[model samples]
Target chain A: MTNQEDQFYITKILEGDSSYYTHLVNRYKNLVYSIVLRMLKNEDDAHEVAQDVFVKVYTSLASFKGDAKFSTWIYKIAYHKCLDALKKKKRNFDTVSIDATYEIGIDQVENGLGQLETAERKEIINKAILSLKEDYAAILTLYYFEELSLKEITKVVGGTLDNVKIKLYRGRKMLFGILKKQLDPETLAIYERGTK
Target chain B: MKEEQNKEMEALSKKLFKEVELQSPDSNFEFKVMEQISSLPIPGSMAKYKAPFSKWVIPITIITLIGSILLILLFGTGNQYDIMSKLPSFNFEAISSPLQRIPKTVIFAMLALAVLLFAQIPILKVTFKNRWH
Candidate 1:
């Protein structure tokens, strides 16, 4: 729904037609879920945290000020919830070493993925995205998947536009490195079985 | 040659990233979140007027108030009495007896309210600090 429609629903809900909030929950749940999922990387944890994000959004809806798009605001909430959960678990994104990477020759790196079915390739990319540092994964998700403007992402991620740009640039490179590693021949042969 | 390889990699990454759509959760995820939201007692701020006055209202109110004060200070000498006389007055004599009749229960309630307000002092301090800073 449009931001105008979001405002309408918000006003209606505030005016005591609380059911209109269902429209908002429906509109943003996936956007919330995907951001949380990419950061947390566990389906159950992601689902729980996604629910928390919506609850936080609903509870804080009155403070939303309309200074940003409703989507950006909700994304900011989801990002924070993920961060809080990670902090609580004392779990940092484990950055695998470049040596840990599966070093396929350059041709094999691109060509093996090229030969895969669309579904297999998508799985490869999804796995690669999840393999990056949590911050990088989140940046990539916001930029590439959610299609937020860099400024919007900076608001969500809390940094300067230059910081977001640098992260986005580095995030793409890291994602590529992960994808290159995962597309090695043995891994491709395994995925060719239509497994994992 | 390096530039050509970089261009090719950029193209491939773009194609792959674009293919990654925002993934949907389980079919019932929206219902699940709404269920939780529904369970939480709607906060007082969620009430209609607790919905903020239009953001413009604050600046406008301040400006109008300041303008009125300035108008009175500079040019309202003759009209000051008129504006003062125009203010609606309460018939407090009727209210005074009933107010005196308020029971010990209400006195206790007032004490409780005072305690609550005292409790809120730190919160108010933080709120003002954040607002001004």
Candidate 2:
């Protein structure tokens, strides 16, 4: 929905017709759920945290001054809620170093990706994203999947634009590195020969 | 050369991400959220206002502590005369003589009750904040 449309429902809800909130919730559920799931990496936890995000959004709707898009605002809430859940669970993911990411050539990753079926490619990408550190995974998701610009992402992730840019740059490389690792040499060789 | 490769990588990643479907919550996700929202107090409704207990705690504590210390000084020891002599303008005996008639056991019990009540404020504040949030 457009920001104007969002503001319309927000106005109605603020005027005490709270049923209009269902519209807002329906609009952003998938977007919010996707981000939460990507960060927490657990379906059950994602479900719970996503719901909490909406309930929080509903309760705090009065404070939303329309300074940012509703999507960005909800994303900020989802991001922090996921962090809280991760902190509570004390779960950590192995972060691939930037040097390691750089060592893997992009041409090799692209060549390997060209060999996989679309479904396989999708699975590999999703799994690779889920394996990265939370901040990198979240930044990549926000930038690539949600199509939020670096500035909007900064607002959601709460850092300088340069910091987000660095994360995005490194995150994309890390994702390519992970994807290359997931594609076995045999599969790439077979597909490469088939293409030739 | 590096910039061209980075551009290619960006394009490839974007194309791949477009295929990554959003993970949906359960079918009842919206219903569950709405149910929770319905139970919430409507904005601007006459929801019972709960002032944080901690805000009142400081002043109440200061008053309680001062009152207790004065009571102890006036009755807990033989130093009532010393305190009274210092505040000669005030008639301390009139206040202390009547309070002294109360049994020492009752006085101590009241003081203990006040202490317990103040201690419970923090625990109760935390409980209420947790429940509300």
Candidate 3:
């Protein structure tokens, strides 16, 4: 929904028609979930953190001044909630290798994207996205997956646009290396069919 | 040739991540999100009406009280004639007889209650101020 549309629901909520908030929650659910999942790997944890993200959005709705798109604002909150949860658990994002858990599936990835289900293809892409460091992964998801501009990303990641641009550049390079390393030659060829 | 190869590499990498998978939560996700939102106290509710309540109010009142007491104590010890000399005083002839008829018991009770209140109020004020901190 547009900012004006979100504002209509927020006004209704502040005026006591709090049930109108359900639309806002449903609207951003997937976006928030995707970002949270990238930040924290576990599905169960992502689900729980997504709930906190919405509740935070609902409670803090009054402070949203339409300065940024509703998507960026909510994403910012979700990003922060994930960071805070990480800190509380003393899980250092800097040191934890996100790609360490996965067995690199060279055989399957080499099979080529010949007739893979649309959903399965995305699932493979997600595995490749996970190979970067956490910050890089998040930025990659926001820029490529979420289609957020560097300005909007700066809002979510709390850094200057230059920093986000740098991350996006480096993150793209890292994803290239990781995917190249994990995918067999034939599959990589199919995935890169249109380019050059 | 070098620039061309670099461009080709960048293009190839771009194609791989171009169609990113947007991962979503389970189907009942909205309902679950609503459940949590329902449990939370509404925004601004927690901070309701909690003004700083003027920290100086108690101190200023206390200082004014002590100043008043000091002024009263200083003048109360003077001889009646010396006090009367400062202002021309005429006794209220009409209320003089009624004052004598007041019961000593009632007067002593009022005096005791006043003393207790005056003694306890400063202590109560201090305790109340500390609770805010």
| Candidate with maximal lDDT | 2
Candidate 2 Cα misplacement greater than 4 A, ranges: A98-101, A191-196, B44-133
Model 1 chain A worst lDDT run, 10 consecutive residues: A96-105
TM-score per model over all chains: 0.66, 0.72, 0.62
lDDT of 2 by residue, A1-196 (tens): 5899999999987776778989988989998998888888889999999999999998888889998999999999999999999989998767665563266666667778777889888888889888787888889888887889999999999989999998887888788888878888887676557668
Q: What clash count goes with each model?
A: 0, 0, 0
Global lDDT scores for all candidate models? 0.71, 0.79, 0.66
- Model 2: CAPRI class: acceptable
Candidate 3 clash pair list: none
lDDT of 2 at B72: 65
Angstrom error of the Cα, residue A2, model 3: value is 1.4
Q: How would you encode candidate 1's per-residue C-alpha lDDT over A68-117 as one tens digit per residue?
A: 99889998889999999999998866664344233324454566677788
DockQ of 2: 0.33
Ranking by lDDT: 2, 1, 3
Looking at model 1, the pairs that clash are none
